[model samples]
Target: MGEAKELSQEEIEKIKEEIERLKKEIQYHDWRYYVLADPVISDAEYDKLVLRLRELEEKYPFLRTPDSPTQRVGGKIEGGFPTFPHSIPMLSLDNAFSEEELVEFEKRLKRFLGDENLEIEYSVEPKVDGVSIELIYEGGVLKRALTRGDGYVGEDVTPNVRTIKSIPLRLLGDDIPFLLEIRGEIFMRREDFEILNRELLKAGQKPFANPRNAAAGSLKQIDPSETAKRKLDAVFYASGLIKGVEIKNQKELLQKIFSWGFKVVPDWKIVKGIQEVIEHARYIYGRRKDYPFESDGVVVKVNDFRLREILGEKAKSPRWAIAYKFPAEEVTTRVLWVEFQVGRTGTVTPVAILEPVRISGVLVSRATLHNFDEIRRKDIRIGDWVWVKRSGDVIPEIVKSIPERREGFEIEIEEPRNCPSCGSELYKPQDEVALRCPNMSCPAQIIERIKHFVSRNAFDIEGLGEAIITQLVTKGIVKDISDIFFLRKIDLLKFWGIGDKLASKIIDNISKSKEIPLDKFIFALGIRHVGESVAKILAKRFRTLDEFLTANPKEIETIYGLGPAVAQSVEKFLRDEKNIASIKRMLQAGVKVLDYHEESEQRKKGALSGKTFVFTGTLKSMTREEAKKLVIENGGKVLDTITSHVNFLVVGDLGDRGTTSKLEKAKKLGIKLITEEEFLSMIKGS
Candidate 1:
C-alpha cells in the first residue's frame, strides 16, 4: 500500500482493475460464508482479500466509493435517530386466505394484464413474521438501516442494525450499485427468543408475548447494546431502492441478493402456475415448525418483473404479490353461560364459561367476551355453538356464534345492572362504554384489587396468585388489600389448601411487600386512570403520602401530564372516606411507603422540565398516563387544558369533538403538533 500521488496511466488502470478483482473475490467468499453458510475459503484467506482491498482503497483515495468493501467497517454511534425517505415506496402485500382466493388472485393478475393465455410463473416463499427493514448500501458498504415507517419515511436505525452479525457490513459483489436499498425482515430465532424470555422471567422482568414481539422490542430499543445481545437475524426478500443495475424477475432478484452475500428467505421456489403455488404454500404451512424463525404464512408473487409492472399496485398493496395467511387455529364449543367479572379498576368484563374444548393443543374451558358491549355486538347467547380461536395460540376468544345450529333453549343474555358478587349498583362512566362496579368495597372488586396490589409491577408479592386471593377473600381473611398484612399463620393454616410450609411462604411474601416504593404503593391502591407510569409521576411530584393526600385537585392539575379526567379521579378517590380509611389501616399494619424525595430533586434537572405538554386522543403504543409519565420523568410538564404556555400538543387517534377543540386552540396558540411516534422517539432519546 502506498500514499495517493500522481501515477502513470498504466499504474492507475492496473490498480483499478486489481481493486475490482479483489472486490469480486471477497463478495464470492462472503456469499459462500454468509448466505450459503458454506465457506469455500478459510477465514485467514478471506481476511487477506479484504485487507488487500482496504490497502488499495487507502492508497487510491479517489477510487474509494460508498460501496467499497473497506467502508463496511461499521461502528459509528448515532446521537439521535433521523427520518430517512425511502428511495422507492415500500408497499405491503394483499392477503389470500384459501386456495380459492389464491386462484382468484391469479385471475386478477391475468385480468389486469389482459392476457388470458399468458402463463405466469409464481415464486412462493414463507412470509416471515418480523420487523420490516430497508438496508441501504453505497458503493459496497452498508450505509443506513431503516424501519418500514409508513412506507415512505422511516427512522434510521443504522447503529442497532450494525450489531446484527447476519447482516453483511458491505455488499460482496464487484458490481455493487451506487445506492441499493434491500428490504428484509429482521427477527429473533425461536430458540434465542425462548432463552431471552427465560432470562427476563428469571430477572423478574415481564417476558415477551412471542418471538415476533421479542424481535420488534429488541430492534426498537434505544440502546444498541441491548439489541446486540438479542442476536437478531435477517433475510432479504425484495429491493426497495436500486441503482446501477436492473433485475428481471422475483427469482432473479432473490438470486442476485443472495449472490451479493445477502441472506434471502430459505425454501423459496419458482413454480410454473397457480396450482404449484398452492402446493408450495401448503407444504410451507405444514412444515412451518421446522424453520428456525416464526412465520405467519407464505407469500406468493408473479415471477416475472415485467408482468409485475404491468399488473401494477393498489394504494395499500401490490397486485402482483399476495400473502396466503394460514387459517386461524380454531375450535367449536357451546357457551354454557356468560359471567360478568369485576376488575381491580372496577371495570366489569364478561367471561364466557364454555363446554370444555381443545384448541391449539390447549384445553379452553373459558374465554373472555371482553365486555357486555362486545357480547351484544357479537350476538353471543347462552347454549349457542360458537367458534373459538386462540389469538397467537395463547388467549382463547370467541370469534363468532353459529345461528343455524342454535337450539330453542338458547337464552339471550341481559347486561348486569348490579355487581354480581356484592349486589352493588353498577354505573357507566362518561365517555366510556363498559359498565363498572363503582363500589370499592364490592367483594369481587376487593379480590381483584388485592390480587393487583400483590401482582408484579405493584407490590410484587409472590405466592399471592388469583387462587390464593380468592381463598383469602372467600374466608374473610382478606376483605381488603390491607388485610393481607394482618393475616396470622394460624388463620392461614385453617384454609383447606394451606400447609405449614405454604403458609409460611405466603406470610413471608406478605411481610416483604410491606417495604415498597411510594410509586408501587400508589399503583397498588388501584386508582382509576393512575397506572404504574402515572404512579411514578405522582410519587416523584409528591415526596410523601401526606403530601399526595393533601394536594388539591387544582394543584394536581398544574402538574404536567395529568389530564382533567385523571385529576378529577384522584381528587374524588382521596375525598372518599372508605379509601382514606383503607390507607390508614395499611399504614397502621406496618406498610412503609419509601419516599423518593431525593430522586424527585434529581429529576428536576431532567431534559423535559419547564416545557408544558398537552396530549389529545388515544395513543397506540402506550396509554395517556404512560405518555404523561415519560414527559414528567424527563422534567417536562403536562397540562390538562392546552394553553399558550404549552410547547407541544401530542395527538393520536383523536375523537371528532376533542380534535376540533384542541386543534383550534393549538393553532391559536401557535403550538407545535407532535405525532405519537415523534413523541415516543423523543422520549426514547431523552
Candidate 2:
C-alpha cells in the first residue's frame, strides 16, 4: 500500500466542515423521506451522500461524532435495559367511549375548576395505538430514549430508538431548548407491520399480534440493527420536561417540536368549546380507517398550557385530558366451523372458525364464541353469516348472529359432550357457563398447563415456547410440568430442531427457573380460580409453600379477599393426591419457592402499612393490576370485595354510568372514599 500523506491543519479543518455539511444533508434527506414523506432526492442519490460521509469518516476517524447520522445503529446493548426516572411523569388519559362521555369529560373539567359555564379551548389529536417513549435532548443533541415503563420511570432504549430514521439525531433549528424531553409514540405503520410479520413467518419465527406489539418488540431489540430492519416510526405529540423554551399552548408546542425536525401527528385541531371537540373527535373517528397507522381514539386536551396546569392531574392520568375511544369495528363474516379448545384449567372454549376477513388491518380468521351458553344465547350457527367485532388489540368476537341471512342449510352449533383432544366426557359446574374436562391428565390440559407454567409471569423459561413444549409432550418426554425441571440437555438435543447451542440455552433457562418467588410458583401451578393477584395474596398470607399447601378451604376463605369459590378450588387442587405427588416430585427435582415477604424491616413499615384499599370504576392513569401492584409495593392491601374491614375506596372516573355495587356498599359502610389522585398522592408521599 502507498504511504498516505498527512493533511495540513487547514485541510483538516476543511474536511471537518465537509463532514458536518454531509451530516446535515443526510439528516435533511432523512427528514424529508421519513417525517415529511416527501424526499427531494432519489434513494441512490441519498446513498451517495451517506457513502461519501462514511468514507470521509473512515479515512479520518477523529471527524466522527456521536450525533452523526452514520452512528444511528451502534453496537448491541449488554446485560439488559437500565431503568431511569422521568423528570415529569407520563400520565395516561381517561377514556370516553361515547359523545355523552366526552361532554361529561368537559363537564368534569369545569366542575374541577368550579366554572360550570366556562369557555375552554381544546386540542384534539389522534391517539396512536403504539408504545409510549420519551426522547431526551441536551444542548440540542439527542441524548437518550426511554420506554414508558410506568408513569414515573422508564427503560433506557436509546440505541434501538436512535435507529429510527424519523427521529433527528440532533435538533435542526438554532432556537432549540437547552434541555428538552419530547414525549411521543413509537409505532409501525400497517403496511410495515404486515411486511415484517410476513418476513418473520418466512424465517420460521412467530409473527407479531399487532402493529403496537411489533413496534414494542422492535424497540426492545438487543441490537439496534435489528430494530432498524423493523422500519419503526415515531411522532412527537407532547413535551415532558423542557427548559429555555416558552410554549403557551398545545398547538404552539407541536409546531415547535416540528420545527426541531420531529414528526408530529398529521391530523390535529384546536377547537373553541366541548361541542367543537366532540365534532373533531367524530371527524377523526370517521377518517380512522384511512390513516396509515393504528389509532384507537382521539385525545382531547386543554389547548392552553396554563389551563392544563390549573386543572392538574390525577394519580395516573391528567384531569384536563380525555381519550374519546372510537367504537369497535364490526364486520360480517361467515362461520365456517366451530372448534372446541381445552385450556389449562380444562375449560372447553368454543372458537368459531370464520371465513378470513380483515378488521383494522389485521387478517382475522377466527373469533371467540366465549362459551356454549353464549353460542346458544347469540344463536350462532355453523355456515351462517355473523356480525364479528374487533376492538384495538382485543380478540375478535361474534357480536350477534344474522338469522335473516342464514339459509335452511345452516346447522345449529351445539356444545360438545366430549373433550376434543382427550375424548374425555365434559361436565358443567354449578352457576358456571363453561364446560370443564374433569380429567387432569388429559394431553391437551397437560400441554396447556405446562405452557402456563413456563409463561412469562410464571417460571419465565425463555426458550420453552409452545412449539418446543408440544414436541416434548407429544414425544412423552414430558408427561407433567415437573418433568420440565428434570429435562437433560442430551435429551433436548435429540429433538428435530434442537441443536447443541439451543439445547444448552434451554437447559440453562430451565435450571434458572427452578428457584422462583412463592407467588409466581403458586400462579404457575395453573390453579383454576387463582390468578397472580390471588397468588400474591395467598403467598403473603401463608409466607411459605409448605404453609399454603397445608391450609384448608375454611382457612383460605377466611383470608380477606378470597371468597368461597377460590378457597374451594385451592383446597380441591391441594387435597388431590396426584397434585400433591406432582408437588413433591417438583420439589425433589430441585424447585425452591422463595418466601413472599422478604423485604427489609424498613420496607415492612411503609406509609400505607396495615391499610386496605378497594378500587371502583375505571382508573385512567393506570390499569387495575398496576394500581394493585403499587398498593402491594407500598405495604398496603387491595381487596376485590367491599367489606367492613376495607379502609378506603379509591374511586376513579365512573363516566356516564351510575355508581357500582362496590361504591354503593362502600358508601353504606361509611368507608372513606378517595379519588385516584388522592390514592397516588398517598403512594408518592410514602
Top model by lDDT, which number? 2
331-433 per-residue lDDT for model 1 (tens digits): 8989998888888778988889999885532357889887766777778899999999863333578888899998699999888888888888889987466
The TM-score that candidate 1 achieves is 0.52
Candidate 1 deviant stretches above 4 angstroms? 1-33, 39-80, 331-347, 351-367, 371-396, 399-424, 427-686
Model 2: lDDT of residue 643? 67
The residue-by-residue lDDT of candidate 2 on 1-686, one tens digit each, is 11124777788899899999999999988888988999999999999999999999888887799999999999988756789999999877767777887877787788878898899998899998889999999998999898888678899999999999999989987888999999999999889999998999999998987798899999988788999999999987998888998889999999999999999987899999989988888899888888778887899999999999898875557878888878767899999998998998899999999999977766799998878767877888999999888765556888888999977999988778999989999999885678999999888999999999999889999888888898889889999888998899988887888877678888988888899999999999988867776788899899999899998789888887667767878988988898888889999989988989765565567667878888887675567777887787777777776667789999986533356668888899999999886887687572
Top candidate by TM-score: 2
lDDT of each: 0.79, 0.86
Candidate 2 Cα misplacement greater than 4 A, ranges: 1-5, 42-45, 75-89, 150-156, 194-209, 220-223, 244-248, 460-463, 487-515, 585-592, 598-686
Clashing pairs in 2: 316-621
